[model samples]
Target chain A: SAVISQKPSRDICQRGTSLTIQCQVDSQVTMMFWYRQQPGQSLTLIATANQGSEATYESGFVIDKFPISRPNLTFSTLTVSNMSPEDSSIYLCSGSGRTEAFFGQGTRLTVV
Target chain B: AQSVAQPEDQVNVAEGNPLTVKCTYSVSGNPYLFWYVQYPNRGLQFLLKYITGDNLVKGSYGFEAEFNKSQTSFHLKKPSALVSDSALYFCAVRYPGSARQLTFGSGTQLTVLP
Candidate 1:
């Protein structure tokens, strides 16, 4: 099991600004993933943070909007660029293990 | 492509009663499934996973989930509900052959009323 620690547990940001949420895993993992959970909604997959190359994004989500970086197996970051009120949500990061994946506490971003 | 659905948004169960949270999956091949629980003001914690073999899988805090292939369902169950068991439950699925990431369900909020 890996413990992922995410920075800036909760932050209120102004519109048009960007916030970068960092996650650090206690051990190495094969893949790192990012997700978004809006108010009263389920989680949506943002992207898969690859260690060396560019991240793999899901449909409706683009790299420019949610840029992800995985410098190593145990570290990754997701930046919410050009924030808006709609972008206000909880951003969570997870590390895929052998069987079950572990998630971080999540960074709650509120854009006003 | 691959997805899981938790039909119910909210489930209320009285304490000491059995509880079930329904989840269904749609995929091409075999389903790699997982269950997670998010307590109030906390991150998601892995409850259990069903990769193969066992249909009834036990997990943390006396929680268990039954995997049904015929119905394409994996419902989380607890014999005796506790007030602390009240939380948001999420079901996740990974494609057996191709996909690298897990598709998550919308999530179900469980309330174990005292």
Candidate 2:
């Protein structure tokens, strides 16, 4: 299992501001992913951050809104751009391993 | 596309009683199933997973899950619940050879009372 560390554990941002959440892993990994958990809802995949390449966004999500960057194998960042009150949610980062996956502590964003 | 379903929203049980959290999934090919637990303000912790071989997979904290392919279900169970076991539980699935993304269930909130 890999140890993932995420920054800005919790933050309060203005409606029009943008926040970038960072994820760092203890070990190098092949795949990294981003997910969002809305209030009282299940997790929804935001995108798959490919190392040295553009992240692949899931349906109902777009790159313009959720820009992701994976410069290396052990680190990635997800930026919530032009946030709104609806953007308030828990953002999580995950890394895939040989058998299972591991998750970071998660960033709780509150848009006001 | 792969998806997971956890029917119950919340489950209440006594500390000494057995606890079960139901999960079902749908996948095009063989599925990789997993169970994760989350304490408040914490990351999701991997409990157990069923890749192949065994029908019963045991994991951390004396938790086990039975995979019934015929019924398309993988239910998490523990012989005796503990007060500390009260948390949010999630069931997730992915196609072994597909994308690295996981489809998670709605999550089940377990409350173990002493």
Candidate 3:
């Protein structure tokens, strides 16, 4: 399993502010993804971060709202734009190898 | 679309007793199943995975899961429950062809009482 590091383990943002969370994996992985999870709730897929191309968003997610970027195999970023109190949740990033996907510590976001 | 289900929202067991968290999945192809545990305010930690071969797969923190193809289920188990084992457990599946993105279950909250 690769070691994943997420910057700014947590943050508190104003309702109209935008915040970007960064995910870095110690080793190169074939797949990278972003997810949103409310505390004590199941995870919701945000998007598939593709290297050198635009991300593939899930049905409820969009580039204009939750933008994702994967510049390379080991690094990706997810930015929450036009945030609102409803956007408050824990943001996670994961990378996959041959069998399993390993996750980062997660970025806890609180919107006020 | 691939999907996973954890029928029980919560499961409670006495300490030192065996424990099981049920999970069932639906997929178009041979299933690649995984179990993960998340402690409060923490990231998900991989427990075990079943890709092929053996039906019973063992993983971290004294946890194991049995992959029953006939039932389309992968249930996490521990021989003896510990208070520390209590957490949110998620069952996930992935298709190798679909960029291997995971489809996670609703999650089961396990509480091991001492």
Candidate 4:
């Protein structure tokens, strides 16, 4: 299994501001995904980040609101734009390989 | 659309007793089933997966799941429960041969009491 990590385990931000969450993997991987877990809810896929290309957003998410950057196979970032209280949730990153799926610690964002 | 359903919102079991967490899925094609566990403030950890071959798949932390294709269910099981097993359990599924994405169940909180 791969070891994945995310920076700024948590943060509190004011509404209208933006916050970028970073995810790093121990090794290069082919599949990297982002997900959002709202309060008392199941996780929802945000996008699939492809190295050197644009991320593929899921049905309810758009690039404008959740811009993603993946410069390489082991690193990616998700920026939440124009934050609102509703944006408060835990953001998780996952990487998939032939054997197992590994996830990062996750970033807990609180928008006030 | 592909989706998973964890019938029980929570499962309570006494330590040293057997346990089972039920899961059912719906998908257009054959599904790749997986079970994951999450501790408080921690990332989801891979428990086990049923890609092919065996009907029973063993995973990390002494966990196993039985895949019943006829019933479209993959329920997690353990011979003996532990207090440490208390956590959120999630069942996920992906369509066969597709890296498209995984559909997750609502999740079940498993609490093992001493």
TM-score of the second chain of model 4 compared to its true counterpart: 0.96
Residue pairs in collision within model 3: none
DockQ of each model vs. true complex: 0.77, 0.88, 0.84, 0.66
Error of 2 at B62 (Å): 0.8
Ranking by lDDT: 2, 3, 4, 1
Recovered native contacts in candidate 3, as a fraction?
0.74
Off by over 4 Å in 3: none
Q: What's model 3's lDDT at B114?
A: 90
**Global lDDT of each candidate:** 0.90, 0.94, 0.91, 0.91
Per-residue lDDT of candidate 1, residues B1-114 (tens digit): 888999999999999999999999998788889999987656788899999998999999999999999999999999999999999999999886744577889999999999
Model 4, position A96, has a per-residue lDDT of 81
lDDT of 1 at B53: 95
Error of 4 at A23 (Å): 0.7
List the lowest-lDDT window of 10 residues for candidate 2 chain A. Answer: A23-32
Q: Which candidate should be chosen as best, given DockQ against the real structure?
A: 2
Higher-lDDT candidate of 3 and 4: 3
- Tens digits of per-residue lDDT for model 3, A7-112: 8799999999999999998775778899999766799889999999999998989999998889888899999999999999999999888789999989999999
How close to the true structure is residue A111 of candidate 4, measured as C-alpha lDDT?
Answer: 95
**Candidate 2: pairs in clash:** none
